[model samples]
Target: MRLEKQQITAGFIKQKTIEKGAALCGIAPIERFINAPHGFHPTDILPQCRSVIVFASPFPISTLSCNTNSPYTFVRNKMVEKTDQISFLLAVELEQEGILAVPIPCAEPYDYWDESRNHGRGILSLKHSAHLAGLGNLGKNTLLVNRTYGNMIWLGAVLVSAELEGDSIDMETLCPSGCTLCLDKCPQHALDGKTIDQKLCREKSISCTPGGGWVLSCNICRKICPANRVIKQNL
Candidate 1:
């Protein structure tokens, strides 16, 4: 009966997130995060967390083809904002149901920052959270590659104090064997298969216009990935 209740709660959470505009939703038990970085575990952010709810919204493929970086940057910013809002509302709704839920920020304002390496990490790594939720597998470029949406999605998550059933982890290899397009195409050589050199990536990928507007100046890794192109064909 307790297990049934957990399943029911999980179902409600997933359904509500989808209804709230999430393109996809999956849940992961806290036990699945045993390997998460010491200070970045779900329990670190919410000590009572027993499960994680991960969701995503697709990024506009049209913006990827834009000649200027403005469209891509604009869409990226909006996606972050929208995803964060969804997580926030989901948490509020769960709390009202007498369930403890904590929303993890989709981006920025994180406590971990390494100035020497120009590296930053969110309180909970949303990509890994999404992976553990069985939403997708991590690609060579270090992006979450969902089977349907590919890597063209923004992620958000909520930590819940409910031992809900977790979706099966996707063990399928999404990246084609011998594919090094992302690694070779990276202007900054920031990608090394399993990880990214944030310092190098940030220098070229992010820039400020003369007018002080921020721009996503580069995205060769994302653009050149074969997985990223799958969504276009499907559309």
Candidate 2:
């Protein structure tokens, strides 16, 4: 596609995302993630990838504090399902426009993890993708903290073969100066200032289904962060 035509198509994709229930949407050229770790790049998933469409579906902030057994669990689960539906629909829409697009799921891994690590690593880190897409900045807690939705948001992505313009990164830092709330709040101390111990976090936060129901066992890091204070004030 021509440069101008690609831009118009990108615009249409973004609009379609919002119309389909996403609260935020932006584009990220595959070049922006050239240095992404092995097996995590758009090209790694789809070799012909030229652009990435990342979008966010915000959830109620109140539900961040809910226990696994609480009613908010249902709401959170529904949001996750809704995000998948939106991404799938967008991919179909793009295909109808004669653009090849592949939707990256919001939850659930494409395959099993290495037994030694047992970490929950998706093909792409949605938070990092969201940052690159200019939807938000990454917080110290490893969550994408959008100015409006804070860290209480789910992200989805789509890879496209058509060339499209990417959004500039948001350089603004959402973490407060000298704040260690998230690190301190972590029950397993899974987060250091520079990185997160995903194995520890996953083990502590995720509950296996014995019967068959969703259970996010913990979210202390997300709940204690000051990044969401702006959203709180607005409410």
Candidate 3:
């Protein structure tokens, strides 16, 4: 029956995501997702997107270092590759069993907070969505704060046609509301509590590169959050 299989799909998805390296996973309605502004606007997406299956892959803590910018700096982009691969794999598995699975692409890749656009698409505030999906809370650095998983998690979501119950997480209830360790660790001062001055962040970030205040990323805030202190997964 469709009903029985719908429930089975969740278990399959969970198994596949973890098998493919997900550290945590949850589901939410597409309606709950669009309101998030961290990366991009999902407002126009159809209601056919009945369920959103969210997942996170863990990042390494011990391997982090200044000289390790090659890996840490490219963490987001790299996570995209891994997430995309696993997503499609799940989709294929789901489809074979007559369950619908659609992998939603990650946010557009770009210098999201570019001064010219005044509209940052990629850096949408997705931590709350993550929390609402039961992934985690926002950390001191303003990143998703998973108590056991730490700050070392990359996110992905599946917009499925299959109707499923949405999960909710109380972020405020989980995290210590006023911690600022993430801010203290930020070298670029990108984070000042929950509000980030992107101009200041970009300006300081670019200074490290060869070009004058403009080049590849300098993910200082994301890389140093204390939530990563107990990270059990690597890369």
lDDT of 2 by residue, 1-235 (tens): 3234345466777888999999899998988996788888778889998989999887788776555545556766788799989999988878877777899888886454767866657888788888889999888898888888789888899888888878888989988888888888898899887688878887888775678765777878888887778777876
Tens-digit per-residue lDDT, 54-77, candidate 3:
788876554466464455546656
Displacement of the residue 112 alpha carbon in candidate 2, Å? 5.4
Query: Which structure among the candidates has the greatest lDDT?
Result: 1
- lDDT (10s digit) by residue, model 1, range 4-106: 3345477888899999999999999998998999899989889999999999999998887889999999999999899989999998888877778898889
Q: Which residues of candidate 3, in runs, are more than 4 Å off?
A: 1-8, 31-43, 66-68, 74-76, 110-119, 123-126, 173-178, 184-188, 206-217, 232-235
Among these predicted structures, which one has the highest TM-score? 1
| Model 3, global lDDT | 0.63
Candidate order by lDDT, highest to lowest? 1, 2, 3
Poorly placed runs, candidate 2 (over 4 Å) = 1-8, 65-69, 110-112, 208-214
Q: Is candidate 1 or candidate 3 better by TM-score?
A: 1
